[model samples]
Target chain A: MITIEFIPFSQMSGLSTEQKIKKILKSVKSDKIVLLQGKLKKDEETELIKLTMSMVNEKFHGIEPAIFSPEIKNTGNFLKFLKEKFINMLLSDRQGITLVGPANLIKEIKRDPEKMQLLLDLNVSRRKKK
Target chain B: MLDKIRSALKSLFSGFFKKKKQLKLGLYGPPNGGKTTLANKICKDWLGEEMGSVSNIPHETREIKIKEQILIKSGNKQLTFNLVDTPGIATRIDYEDFVKAGLDEEEAKTRAKEATKGVIDSIKWLDSVDAVVVVLDATKDPLNQVNITILGNLQAKKIPVLIVGNKIDLKRADIKKIENTFPQYKVVGISAKYGTSVEDFYTELFNLVKP
Candidate 1:
């Protein structure tokens, strides 16, 4: 079975950076793929990488990270916010909602609607093999 | 079909024997040290196009930008290489710092996250590079930990490196200090923005990457 969980930006604010990473690690360790909205803060992400690298060993398939920018919502005229719009357009490939989890559990990732669509496909393919 | 197969076999044999002539050169440095500026100057002079955008804001290039197959000529010598311009390497990345630079809290956090990833990506790219140009701000102290870490890593890998003291046009710029700090390596100073002494930089790079 493929499991995907989305952690919103607001939900992460209450936890300390270390606690937040530990929480993410717990999910990843349990074979649950995490789709984090707005991405992790820099320090937290660094700490997570350090923890992963230190604990890496047999049975821990390496982490796979993928980022995809979700479409932004705004109510301003396209002409007025042209610069912001252009930056956002360019950033579509640069920044995004980041996903991280064990590689064995995820077959592929696509940056589109149903961000977890690949997981469902993986589950189907695995069932077919069985 | 028989002739095609024979020619293909011949080319495959030639590929195995031919030495790679183009080097994969990386431009690595601390944030705001003008890596992209140097990349732009080199690209403009040779390829007639820019590699990527540049900004006064730190970590503006939060991605690995590449320009391929640039050929540089100096005297009777010629060097052809693929250039990789990496994000500035920093010891610390803070979202609050971005907020101070006039970005909103959410935007600051996003930028910080991307910048951090860029740093890691740059470090990983070191493995694939044939040589490196370690760019430094001529106005800053060259004895800092970040510079040392980068040099130590490059040295450990046994990769050839050329130290560049960029931004020589600034009033506070000092190339002699950089030369004194790293006496073992050849140091060339240049104003990447104005393209000053860039020919010397290219000549030194060709010499450093010589097989």
Candidate 2:
């Protein structure tokens, strides 16, 4: 059975933020894809890339979440690392999240996740207009 | 036996008469840096509630998430501290996380820009703060654009800043290296997971606001 945990924002209005994050990182069902994005600083972006790789490497049913970092000053060395991992992660300052996995899991997330979570934890959805 | 009962009754009566005070404190750090965990620990310890969520997912907090006033004590005085948690920040920018969250192209871009603005605003929140605690992951190095920018901003505002080197319990945590990097400030190395060194951290922070 698929496990879905909701982590509230740091405000602590509801779910646990860290547990929510861990769930998002681990909540890959089948062939659905994930993209984690934001205007993150250089270090933050690098940290996420590392987190995503480690999380994906674990046994979550044969899923791989690759990162494409921002543009690097020295393109040669950067490209070499990306090619090694089969991902051209440039290592820039922009914070982004990418997830590709099963469609059913994505649907379940849409049904239960919060808006701020959608913007912060999952992906940002455009539906609620107010 | 009669005296013991009388004393117990007096103590119980005084417990209800105790006054509570709250202090506002801000928790700042980059995305996925474990700032939320530290915040929750302080709150739950004092206020009986979790500080905030600790997540490995970047940008787990997209806005300035504020916790209610937490009543903590400093010496003979009891004060309530308001812990403010904010979104994770970074230099490079991307909207993919938004897209994966299921946003359209135009809206995702707008939200990305708005969230970036929020992070910038949170950094400036340091200026008016009573005191600021910067959470640096011990598993990572100290040098980065966001770190430098934040430190520079705090110094410019003449804010009393404390460095919290969290996750020191991790095997790869290089606490000494972090201290050596930012020698100009007060740094405390602690493992938030084990509750080690938090007392020292709290004391150091309490000393600044003790009135």
Candidate 3:
């Protein structure tokens, strides 16, 4: 069975970049998809990918990550855009949803400004059955 | 009149002595998207030297390679810069994928490890570059996450970007799809292998790095 875990921003608050990555990686390694309450900082995202690479093994492949920031839709409204940008600067964690899943389980994560489509690898279930 | 002549001479002498800051131009994209091929082509055209090897296997470039002081002449104007060819960025790397590409299990595992480091290094190098050339396969779907992530990061950093739709020699190549996918950036289509439309790429480079 596929497991999805929601991690609110409060849980990730006050954590260092490495700690946040470790927390996410721990869940991914356990075969659970992580639904993070807010997006990671740009550098943290890169670090997450880097850490994920080092931990790649026979059992754990890696991660497929996608972020959906609400600010993307506000681009058309100049005042709204400025307001969102200002708010983002004040907040410790930018408001958004970040999805991270084990690469072995998630085939693809297609994203646009409006929505995200997560495609699962049906072959994984077939292998499990065998 | 004498003072004006002295001033003119001083200006000319200063222009001759002043060195322009070398622009760092990076080639980035997904694995097997012909980034190394284009780097080699650019190097050969100006310096008569190749930067790195090329292979059909993905992640052939597992480390960042650079060639310095490449001067390209277009008409009477010349542009010189350091060319950085980075390993392709990907969301995932699997040793079994390498094994399927003809590598032994152990070799595949090692390659995968190096490739992961390569991706990290590529992302880090984004901070240091002045401008970037996003090399992509014209034949493949241009809307993949790897391409989006690379472009998004570049955008966030406000780095000047020029997209190159490579491998136009192939029948399946579709530069239009890439152009439509990214209407915000300038897209140039070329076959980095056969040197097709490469001159146009050089012309675009001049515009891309204009101060």
Candidate 4:
């Protein structure tokens, strides 16, 4: 089982997103298995997507939502895409959870229907990691 | 083809029985946001009827409800409100029944898993309605995702919206904060449980919609 805990920048206050995620993965018992995807080097997106798909195929459903940064480009968008990919793989496959950002942030995004619509398409909320 | 003919016949006859234009207006908000309560108050005081059902549970309204509605005009020139109530958006809906609901599900779920599928569906519905009555719960944290989404999408689509901030009877209800957060909306606070401010709400609604 995996849990994607969104570290809302506001909640995390001073820490950078990568720092918070790195700290989380570092503190957690899971090994190199837990991913850190926001604002990574450009070379990382493909690897992150592949890693996430592999994890889900292994049935590593998330227990909570993963945190992301809006400042982090497609970090949140990518997670949403990952959900579509996972469901495409499972086809009524067991539920999986992947998070985009914190609730408050999601609320902010909600103000922009176009972006929020994208997030819904991405399945960032209900998909396993919040 | 045969079904539509039967439907038109049914409506033609029922129209005589009901004798109302049945203006379709939507009462939309996030889950547990007192949309049903507001709908109930309108049903009782103005419509002179009982509410369909009111519950604290989310997703209680998964489909639309039509009424033998009425339009009461004020002393002004001409205005009326024949209302329709639709399901609240945040409530987890099983669109699998879309076919029964008169739509094809496979085509709809094509957008499934997209974060804003919920928002997209909502935008589409908002367009169908003449005007919108946005409900907010004054008793809870005024800022919520569903309201943000509902209001934002409404604004994006330029749908006429009236913000209903309900449950003012509760001690914790803050009318001003809700007003402040959603300044873009024409906000009103109502104690739907007691029927306070409901008349004015319908009165305002009467002025906005078509007969």
Q: Write the residue-wise lDDT of candidate 2 on A7-82 in tens digits.
A: 2223222334454334445545333344544233333333333344333311221223222334323456976765
Query: Where is model 4 more than 4 Å wrong at Cα?
Result: A1-130, B1-23, B76-78, B91-124, B206-211
| Complex DockQ per candidate | 0.02, 0.02, 0.46, 0.04
* Root-mean-square deviation of candidate 2: 19.1
Best-matching candidate per lDDT = 3
By the DockQ metric, which is better: model 1 or model 3?
3
Candidate 1 lDDT, B84-177, residue by residue in tens: 9999876446566678889998987778777767777787787889899999999987765457557767887898999999999999999999
**TM-score for each predicted model, relative to the true structure:** 0.59, 0.51, 0.84, 0.50
- Give the docking tier of candidate 1: incorrect
List lDDT for all candidates, in order.
0.76, 0.57, 0.89, 0.52
Candidate 2 chain B: worst 10 consecutive residues by lDDT? B15-24
- Calculate the i-RMS of every candidate, to one decimal place: 15.0, 14.0, 1.9, 11.1
In terms of lDDT, the poorest run of 10 residues in model 3 chain A is A67-76
Candidate 3: which pairs clash?
none
Give the alpha carbon lDDT tens digit for every residue of B1-211 in model 2. Answer: 9999999999887765643434557777766667887877887788787855555545656677777767677668666666788666553335556667777878666655655555665754665576678888889867544575566666766767888998988899888877776778778988877788998988888766664
Residue B102, candidate 3: C-alpha displacement in angstroms? 1.5
Judged by DockQ, which candidate is best? 3
- Native-to-model Cα distance after best TM-score fit, residue B165 in candidate 4, in Å: 0.5
What class would a CAPRI assessor give candidate 2's docking? incorrect
Two-way lDDT contest, 1 vs 3, winner:
3
